[model samples]
Target: MKTSLYNIFSWIRFTFLFVAVLMIWALRTLNWIWMRPNRLEKCLRKQGLNGNSYRLTIGVTKESAMIIKEAASKPITFSHDISARVLPSVHNAIKRYGKNCFMWIGTAPRIHITDPTLAKDVFSKYDDFQKYYKTNNPLVKLFIGGVISYEGKKWAKHRSIMNPAFHLDRLKHMLPAFHSSCSDMIRKWEKMVPEMESFELDVWPQFEALTADVISRTAFGSSYGQGTNIFELLKEQSHLTLQAMDSAIYIPGSRFLPTKWNKRMKEIHEQVQASIRSMVNARVEEMMDGGETNEDLLGVLLRYNLKETQQNGVGMTVDDVIAESKLFYFAGQETTSGLLTWTMIVLSKHHEWQDRAREEIFQVFGDRKPDYEGLSRLKIVTMIINEVLRLYPPVVELTRIVREETKLGELTIPAGVSIMVPTILIHNDHEIWGEDACEFNPERFSEGVSKATKGQVTFFPFGWGPRICIAQNFALLEVKMALALILPRFCFDLSPSYAHAPYVVITLQPQFGAHLTIHKIKH
Candidate 1:
């Protein structure tokens, strides 16, 4: 009877302890989702910032999605003013709450910053305002994570090692690969065009192919065939990622659930990593056996990595190499292809600019293959490319998060509030770009990007400050080469079937297609 009474007492004690722990967990979660957000909202209000009232766990995300969906349902008429259609929710928010406002992206408040000064502050102080993880969805990292995702010392180390690969001398060595890819693409286009007449075709996919091929050749060199396979997988992965994001707001730990999107994303990531890992291993083996290092991106990176390891006793691992290489493929293909696509569309609209660009191209190259020296000399072509970038930047906006309280000019930004620097909005700002900000005037960039922005942080198509896109020069060179080759070969104008719809999937791309009639030049 004594033993039975002791056992009952122990069981009762254990039950109470379990319930106490459960209640504590529930209270903390409630504080995180409710109490903390309300506190942040009140704090922002005290500072005179305006925004919609926070709504439960979803916040304004659902409302924003609905607006975006409604805006994307139909294409706006042909005009350079695309800010509304592209970012309807943000645009609406700005209109309603003015510039000095914040919006809830889930529980976190994302403050819109149009002021160039504050944008500069956020960008320059990379450590304070870190790279924003767009969503809490852990699976999103599978597609977008890489060197760009790292912060502080890790970012510095990766940047230092990769810097040599994009040096002017190294880029010049990759010129042959660029020319070869462009030539192949042009040859295919010529085949598509009839002997002495015009043939209508979609140039969007053509540019995508051209850029993909260029990246493959420049990045992988002799192993370009395999690189092509990786590019395709990445393309599909991007689409799946967008779908997953559009489907729902991420619940923490939901990535582990056996969902279809989750499964496919994991599978694609594994495949890409496996393919890249195999290539990296092969190259490392070659180096270990005292084989000569090729000047391709992978080879150059490995060479530098080895040097770093030998000197500092540590370097990037195979996984690190894989991540960087994956970045090269995605960034290289997307940025250039988007630029080239928009260039063609813009040039077609402004025939006079096209004539002048062709005149300049002829003056520089004149029925010969474009050399780097000749490419640099084509000033008119450079201006046109710059104008296109301003009007249709590959990336629409940049987001950064502050982990701790940070001061930006007069405002004191609390920890966990995100900063939204809308690149598209800044690029088209009347105050910054003048009255003709929305117009496609290449003449504005005649004195170069620095002169055009008047030494402000306004024009950052490739981004701004230290953490700018590393391959901006590489992308620009490729564009110059492509435009040089195509201008002397054909005259292009938009086909009647074409629709003027530009939307962002991964980058700003045509909603319909870039259907243009290509008239083969009779030389």
Candidate 2:
């Protein structure tokens, strides 16, 4: 009878413990989905920031996704005012809630910062407002989770190791690789076009291929074939990443599920990693044997990486090097491709700018290969590229998180709120940029970025402050080389089949394609 009583008591205790665990979980979830968001909402509202009250269901994430999809379905007329199509949801939010407002991305409130002073502050204070990589989809973490995703010490370490490769002197060594790739692409175009007739070709895919080839040559040198293969995998991986980020609703352990998209993404990730590792191992072996490092990015990186490991005794592992290489392929390829594609489209629209740029190219190089010094001297080409970047900046917005309570201008932002630095919006704001903000006038940047932004932190195509893109000079130099070669050889105008739909898939791209009538120039 005593034993039976003890068993009954044990069972009752177990039941009580289970119920307590269930209750705790329920409360935490309730806080996450409802109470916390509401509290953040109240905090922002109290600070005079306006926004729609946070909804417990999905917040505004689902609604914003739907709005973006609807906006991207149709093509906009040929005009430089692309913010409406590119960032429809954010654009509408700014219109409805004013510039000093917040929008919900899941439970988190993203505070829109339009003021240049506040933008500058947020950028300068990198530690306080660090990158927010918290995401629902794991694929995003797999692809872009490198130095760009890191903070504090790790970011500094990686940045230091990789900085030498992008130095102007090192980049000059890679100029030959750039020239070779551009020549190959232009040669292909020459073959396609008849003696003097125009050919309706898509420059978007053409530029994509050209940039990929350039990255292959400039990144891996002798391993160009392997580099090419890796980027092809990365390109597909980029698409799958966009699809994986379909909604904000995240189920715990959902990434482990054997969904088709998830499986393919994992496969591609492994393939890319293995490919990069193979190259790194081979290079390391060669380096240990006292082989001279080539001039490509890999050589410079490995050489610097060795120096770092020897001096600091703590350096990037093979895996770390692989991540940086992937970044080089992804960022280097995508940024230059987008910049060149847009420059062509914009120049085509405004033929006068094209004439001016071509004239400058001639005066600087005169049918000769464009050297770095001459490329730098091409002021008109520089202005056109800057204008293109301002109108269609590679990254539309920069996200930073407030892990602790932060102060921005007059507002005291609570912890867990996001800061949205919408570069596209600021770039196109008439109040800051005068009435013709949306128009594609390269003369706005005639003097330079400083004069264009009037010393404000408004024109950040590659970004601003310490965390600015490391490869900015590398990319601009390549673009100049391509233009220097092509501008004097051929002239292009938009094909009637072209649809002017600028949208973001990781970066801004033409929704349809950049179809143009390529006419060989008789010089």
Largest lDDT belongs to which candidate?
A: 2
- What TM-score fits each model? 0.97, 0.98
RMSD of each: 1.5, 1.2
Winning candidate number (TM-score):
2
Candidate 1 TM-score over all chains jointly = 0.97
C-alpha root-mean-square deviation, candidate 1? 1.5
Model 1, range 95-135, lDDT digits (tens) per residue? 89987588888777889998999999989999999998667
Judge candidate 1 at residue 330 and give its lDDT.
90
Local distance difference test, candidate 2: 0.89
Worst ten in a row by lDDT for model 1: 242-251
Indicate the TM-score of model 2: 0.98
